[model samples]
Target: MADAVTEFVLTPEQQDLRRAVRRFCAERLGEDTVRRLAESGTGHDPALWARLGGELGVLGLAVPEELGGAGGGLVDQAVVAEEFGAALVPGPVLGTVGLAVPALVALAGAGLDEDLLASLVEGARTAAFAVPDRGGRFDPALVTVTETGGALTGEVRHVVDGTADVLLVAARTGEEIGLFLTDGGERIPLSTLDRTRRQATVRFSATPARALAVGAGAEQAITAALRVGGALLAAEQVGGAQRMLDRTVAYAGTRLQFGRPIGSFQAVKHRCADMLVLVEHARSTAFHAAWALQDGTDDPDLAVAVAQATCSQAYQQVAQESVQLHGGIGFTWEHAAHLYLKRAVTDAALLGSAAEHRERIAQLVLDGASASGGVRVATG
Candidate 1:
């Protein structure tokens, strides 16, 4: 019998999707377009958003077909996310797809509002998961938003794309935590390090809300959503790191220093080689996490935690190296390197920092060891 193959490779359809998204982004979401949208009031292009949903059906990759979605999974979504990250595509893609879709899907059987999901699938609406903490840590105890008599009241800060048309808010009712759906809130946009992504403070003053899930169910949904977010975010970081690596290598080959291409120098060659290793490592971990989320093969939480820890740090290092490799040109606002660097730095803190994920990974490992009685100590 042949040895079982273990290498992870994208299916033909996935490759096709990647190629199409890359082409679309290159054509429509160039650096100039990204800068313009980042400075715009809305911080996203509505027309391009419509095209993504109506033409590419990217917005519904994780939605079930019965719900008017493509019935695809996280891997499919990761492909699109990677391309978006590479292009630094602006808008609420992360808010709607990465955060909202998973939460809604997890609560689909628990009085989930299908109408809202349908609107998101069609790109007619965008949603934000209004969770506490700017660092992407979703602690149920930190939920201060209170729901009373079908009304939500409290303030949620550091909400990604908080101005979204729909808000899937986590609120406390009595001793139980619940996921509430609301369309009423005062959105105040906040200045952030990553101009490509928007954050805002949402103040809900007795805003009418509908309960989606309460108690244990709501907690589970929230956890699942954040796990998916972290996994996809790892993929996004991999994309950004790969882009920087590519750009740095190309620049090194063409840049002249002392009348010879700088790439020929030992120092430049070593830096590029180190960048390649990091990109490859990040890509492997991120893709594995996506696969785990989709297929349930590995411990999904462990995979996600490892991916987040590895990819976040890798992306930040690569972006920083890319800027330095470009010398003075990369430091300028006119150059695209600064934008990627900002995104990398911001992403490191977006869904918790590298240190946070590493701690989670360690705890998970110890817990697993304890459960299986695998931990042992050596003594003299």
Candidate 2:
């Protein structure tokens, strides 16, 4: 039985949207389409992205309605992200929706850059969020870029949405950090584990940039945006893991050995069952985190962290098991199982590893206790 509370999370309209996206991905974003796009060296089809943005209204899902967005909010993003993950839909959707939109939304709250935000909302433009990669984490300390005489000079690694029309840079200015909207630079694409998504290094060589926001306001907005990004990523991971589990289980029920389906064996049955548990756990955590973040619940950060840590491991485990349970054929290049595994591992390390998130979770709990005076010590 489904939980009553969870059932209402998606209104009738949202449910319809999910069904529509699932159908589109099934009909258009097929395995062949994804493979062809990957091999074409572009790794993304502008036509497909345009359809999604112009027709489905995904590009502007997070933006405010006054600025031309659907104003669907974070939960809506999570729902769409899950479908994207399930189909392994390849493109800059993750970067455009997850990172850049949040930055704009945050900036919008502070009443800055309405024109830029409007352009993005109309799908006429796109932006990639660039943050210095610090050992698999987006640590503020990694930002060492400086601005002088209106020219920005710094480098940020592992920027998502390689096809973005612009860059939303998180840069450091002396002791204060700020964000800048740049006209993009040379994008050095890196060979990443997942070919479905694109990433690159953007080097600013005295690049002329326009500042979006500065000081405390910029910091708060960016932080909130990144947190939403991390939570939505967990939703993606959960969706991918679910797809892998479904594929593995279906294969198990059909593949025969010694005149019997392999699924009949005790060992194989256990593996499939375990995979189900992982997928379910991942789904629950991802949805809860999305809800908390969307509703602005108390301690949203803690909820997001818990979801990131729990869902990361769940997705990785199911993806890894999927390959092994599929036997010899799963090891071949023709098999899609390996691709899911690669994506799983890559997404696990995107914001931070499960282990790293666990560390943060512990710190958050302790810090919260101390802040609220929840801790007590008695000594003679």
Candidate 3:
């Protein structure tokens, strides 16, 4: 009962939006649709993408209304993300809400580029961060950049939605880090294991670029944007994990062994129970991060790290365990369990890994303690 009624102090509007989005995903993008989308090599449904961007208005959930967005906050978008996760709906919800929108907003805050932000918010355009390289460690300082006339040149890899119309690229220009908006840069193809998200190795060979922001301020803006995106991705992972758990439980109940429900057995029951607990915990952590992000709390960054670390593991664990509990059929092409597993693994490493985020949290805590007047001498 508590599981069904677990409350997170959401506004009535947020609750209604959640219900609506959930119903929408269940009706339109159900198990069959999700399976089809995941199996596609492109890792997305372009038709569904158009609907999400143009009709459902999910693309603009985090965008401001004045800029043609729905004027919703991070919490509001988290509700939709939760539904997206639960349905295993494939596309770029995290790409748009988490990365693109936040990048624009952060840049706008710095008064960098209003036109880019407007295009992003209106859903007429999209952008992906070209931060991570082949090793997947995205340090702004390590990024190499060159400028020739009005063009910028460099090689950046693992860019999400790299095929988008616009790209917000972070490049190192001497001692200054720069954010560039490039509409037409050379995109090199890269092999991807996950079929639900597209990635590319970009080669900007003196491509025409507009400077969105620069200097240490660019690094700060990009980092803040990534944090926002990472927190939202956790919510998406929670949704996906919940859906996997539901599907696995339903399968366990129906798949017979020894002339009885497999779910009736202790082993299967334990696995299902563990999945449930992890999903619930992931939900709590994701909501906490979303709340902090929406409220603009001082500890939102730490909350984001915690949520990403916990939710990433929870998603992967639930997905893999769900597939295992389904038996041999789960390994086949007909079943959707493996698809969820792929999405889980891909998303887990997207923003950062569990280990990476945990390390970041430790560092943040240490920094906080150091900033607090060299620690307090507590009384016994």
**Stretches > 4 Å off in candidate 3:** 1-7, 31-43, 109-115, 133-138, 366-380
Model 2 Cα lDDT, one tens digit per residue, 236-336: 99889999999999999999999999999999999999999988888777777777666654356666777789888998899889989899998989999
lDDT of 1 by residue, 82-106 (tens): 8888999898977898899888888
Instruction: Give the TM-score of each candidate.
Output: 0.95, 0.92, 0.88
- What C-alpha lDDT do the candidate models reach, one value each? 0.87, 0.78, 0.75
Error of 3 at 106 (Å): 1.3
For candidate 1, list the clashing residue pairs, or say none: none
Instruction: Give candidate 2's TM-score.
Output: 0.92
- For residues 285-325, write the lDDT of model 3, one tens digit per residue: 88877766666543766778788889999999998998889
| Predicted model with the maximum TM-score | 1
Q: Point out the worst 10-residue segment of candidate 2 by lDDT.
A: 371-380
For every candidate, C-alpha RMSD to the true structure in Å: 3.5, 4.2, 4.4
- Whole-model lDDT for model 3 versus the true structure? 0.75
